[model samples]
Target chain A: MSGAPATIKDIARLLGISVSTVSRALKDHPDISADTKEKVNETARRLNYRPNALALGLKSSKSNTIGVIIPEIVHFFFSSVISGIEDAAYETGYNVMVCQTNEMYERETMVAKALLDHRVDGVLVSVAKTSTKFDHLTLLQDNGIPLVFFDRVCAFIETDAVVVDDYKGAYMASEHLISVGCRNIVHLSAPENLLIGKLRKVGYCRALEDNNLQVDPYNIYLCDTSEKVEEKIGRILDRHPRPDGFFAVNDSTAIAVIQHIKKAGLKVPEDIAVVGFGDGPVATICSPTLTTIEQNGYEIGYEAMRFLLDRINKGITAIVARKKVFAPVLVKRESTARRFENR
Target chain B: MSGAPATIKDIARLLGISVSTVSRALKDHPDISADTKEKVNETARRLNYRPNALALGLKSSKSNTIGVIIPEIVHFFFSSVISGIEDAAYETGYNVMVCQTNEMYERETMVAKALLDHRVDGVLVSVAKTSTKFDHLTLLQDNGIPLVFFDRVCAFIETDAVVVDDYKGAYMASEHLISVGCRNIVHLSAPENLLIGKLRKVGYCRALEDNNLQVDPYNIYLCDTSEKVEEKIGRILDRHPRPDGFFAVNDSTAIAVIQHIKKAGLKVPEDIAVVGFGDGPVATICSPTLTTIEQNGYEIGYEAMRFLLDRINKGITAIVARKKVFAPVLVKRESTARRFENR
Candidate 1:
């Protein structure tokens, strides 16, 4: 009456009928009398009533909503992936519900359970850095919910996943530094347990060996955060015959390395060349700009969601888990643009 | 039985009772016999069945979930706000569902409707930049849902809102530039339709007036996005008696301004000084590091969620609208550190 769309309750009240009776009559239920159905239809027409999609879902068993769980929403790469997922969902006429675990195992478990309880049509996830167990994720599958993993996947889970070619990206990064005439290189790596960490390390070693340089285990450090970079970089820079090149796991880490290098009175490219993975916005914002691997996070997200929806539409049946691996592109910038005359 | 937690459906299947009967028996329904209730309780204990919070919430007419609607998810400020909201919700035994509108009016209206259909216990909002009308938000209120706004708020809404003191922050920014000996300063402003844009422009004008400098209408340009900044900055830079300082609506725009200025051969804080709002991650990563206002996005989100929970607990009594405004702090960085000796 106030210009807001009429609901079933309003239609029932107008006709002095029970809400359920109005609902039944509107649906043309066999239990309802013909006279009641006609009256309900006429009254519904008069009120311009439209059923709520979610309320309709209660009967149809479809929410038309998808859930996404990520390690951190504030991280640029993850956020970009979410943006991609949102774009795909919006186009498909679906709403998205996002939850972040803040990179905690306990929070990841809790949010996973919460998503299950909400009965979303499907779920997209990127496993947390600290998560070593998968019982919570297994439960979602046990309950027959479709799940897709992106960026960070549960290795043992049989499901669709989308990932970037971390190994190739790392190889390109290490090789780029070598091409710029750096003999000894240092790698700021992720936790060894993660697939990304292992692959990147292997790639870095392979590139060194191809160039006839021995892989020095002492040059690699388990440092991904800024604080770790600041604390450990000084020691590395002070070592006799200091490392001439630095390759980091991500953009922020690379930027931090540059800042510390500059603070220690060393010039980037001139003294210590640097390269990073994940071409986030900070890559362009940083001084001397960062040359890094371009991870197509948005495309990964869009493809993951598409895979999930395909499974959702196909219904509960055994299907082999699928994976789509996107190739990484090396974006050259000032940070590693040494020897411009050489190549 | 296989290490996964047993659900109510499992209990019903084991006892060969209807799902509804098992649910009612477990809840100690009056119509259920003592024997049935005892059987249900023992089975639940033996199976280590934990009640799903959302399932229980359905029975209690509460979802135990709060909805958040933002303009974008990848944005650093908005993501920080969301992180604050999530932190508060987790501590209070609540789940959060987030949606982003990508600054589109239609998407905002659709998502608002979807949140309503999902029956979230309450909602927290930061209206879209393109949202000129308030019908979608008003509909949420009409449906008796508790609404709280943060950062961006609708003027006509009778609800709690948390915002930063944009006017005062702008005043400080302009005054700081003047103190650094900037005679002709230009502002890269937001659209006038937004409250932040209007207040910030007024504050800039007042600062000029207070310093006995005439406010040049030509210096105030309606430019906020990076694309707009790129398209319009060249002409401004080419103007005779060029602007000696720049104040932008946000960090990204300020960073873009600085890039263009440097490209034009003007040194930061030497030939031109710059200030930005919102001390996001990019502010620190950018060259010359941005001098900007700390908007306290996390605190604003936490407080907005607190106010929303308060209203939700009060159960829909006609209450007066409340607002909390946070003071802004200016962070000094190399971008505007011209008078290092004097200060």
Candidate 2:
């Protein structure tokens, strides 16, 4: 009969044990004898026994999955963060449902709804650029779903979040440039609407004000593209009394500035010292190596998932408004060294 | 009563419409009038009418979620591929469950089982380094689950796969190095067990044979880094009669080689030219920007999903297996140029 179906009764009859004892042994219950449990497990493997997926699903209202929504996954920083999250979640027997919003509010909302409709146990979100509203997020929370935000968080929602201290990271970057004897510092910024962008700007302003340097609006160029930053840096160099230092929100833009400086027959650190946020792999490979603020994206992701699991396991009904801020450390590299040393 | 339990009947009563019309309007049936649909939709929104997740789950017996398992997420190539997958899946009303195997076979099996237990509608997989067996994957297929393999795929599994032309890409990279006047070219290889690694080595050998260069066993370095590849590269460089040209299997290792070369007081492309696979952002930002093979990771992901969707929609059970291979293009940067020119 194709190696008789190994039900609890079959196992009990074979082992001369009670059916309840056989079942407990199969489950590794504390009450079962160690030898019996081992034998049951070995026999089950030999029989090629398979558990019922539907029964498990019915017993646990949870699909054992958490949904994650991000703007994009191609960026170096975001990928590292996802690695960290995946590692943590895997350890806890949880899976992640990843969706990309493509920086569109409608798509983000649709993704959230779809995840909810899938009955995902919890959610971890990094809002899209276009997500100025949080009605979609509220819908998830209103259904008693545990939600956690990391990196790009929505300020309108009340929930746990893991974010780097962008203000301090940006401040330290600017301060490093200042310490390197650069005065006319230019801050290449992101779209000024997001909280991260705003915080970074505040940090830049504080650093300049602390150094008794005038915060010129002209010095703060707003652009999203690295190509635009390169072009903007070129134009800035052509202007009278060119900036001696630059701080960018990311390594891509900082690398572009370095390329532009070299094209202008200028030297890094010697001619224009620069610093960037997020000490990603690009920051190290850049010629002269970028002296930037290291945001521990891995840690942020790990902690975000941990916080989410905590809420999920506890059956959290109310949105617990808490912000877990990770401090950013400055990684000093060759890009922002003292003037007139190498040349 | 707080509200007369607003349903299709209540909506019809309030709008002076039939229950069928209200239901059709809610579903946005093509036959329903646009004005009626809009009015019913607005009323449903105002009344906080939401569909039952469990009821929908029962009707479709599909979660509308796809599982994605990868070896690692921190790699730039994988992340970009995931972005493409996310884009395509979101467009088709599917969410992705992301899991990482960390290159461990056991973890891969665990993740596959977990995804199946979660009842994901389908799966996209990139096999892990230690995965030589296809038992876990075969199990998914046995259970009537749709599975698609991308990047690193298994030969035994008869399923849809999306992969790059690794052999051709490696041949092109090696040929380019030869054309640039390098007689001795060394290949820095990954673990020689996997299909991609073996294919790349074959391509490298093909190029050397075409150029009438002897295939020296010493020229091929097997990199098995306990943690990092930098130390391995260092040892390779310290050997006698250092190769005039080098090709790495991936960008991370290639970047590490660049750092080591600089530390050894050698210049890139001039002292020893180098080419890397995977045209990641690191390739662009690295000193003397790396020349490498650019794989369309996003396209691979998008197409893999499309193939799986086709299978799902067509109800094709156990059809002839198919393989889709994408060609990798060459991206020339400063790292492989005959003369180092800053632009």
How large a fraction of the reference contact set does each model reproduce?
A: 0.36, 0.58
> In candidate 2 chain B, where is summed lDDT lowest over 10 consecutive residues?
B1-10
Candidate 1 collision pairs: none
Estimate the TM-score for candidate 2. Answer: 0.87
Clashes (N, CA, C under 3 Å) per candidate: 0, 0
Best by TM-score: 1
Q: Lowest summed lDDT over 10 consecutive residues: which window, candidate 2 chain A? A: A1-10
What is the C-alpha lDDT profile of model 1 across A14-103, one tens digit per residue? 888899999899888999999989989998877645566545554565767788999888888998898899889988977787888988
Per-residue lDDT over B123-220 for candidate 1, one digit per residue giving the tens place of the 0 to 100 score: 99998888899988877776667899898877777788899998999999999999888989999898777788888999999999999999999999
| Candidate 2 backbone collisions, by pair | none
lDDT scores of the candidates, listed in order = 0.86, 0.80
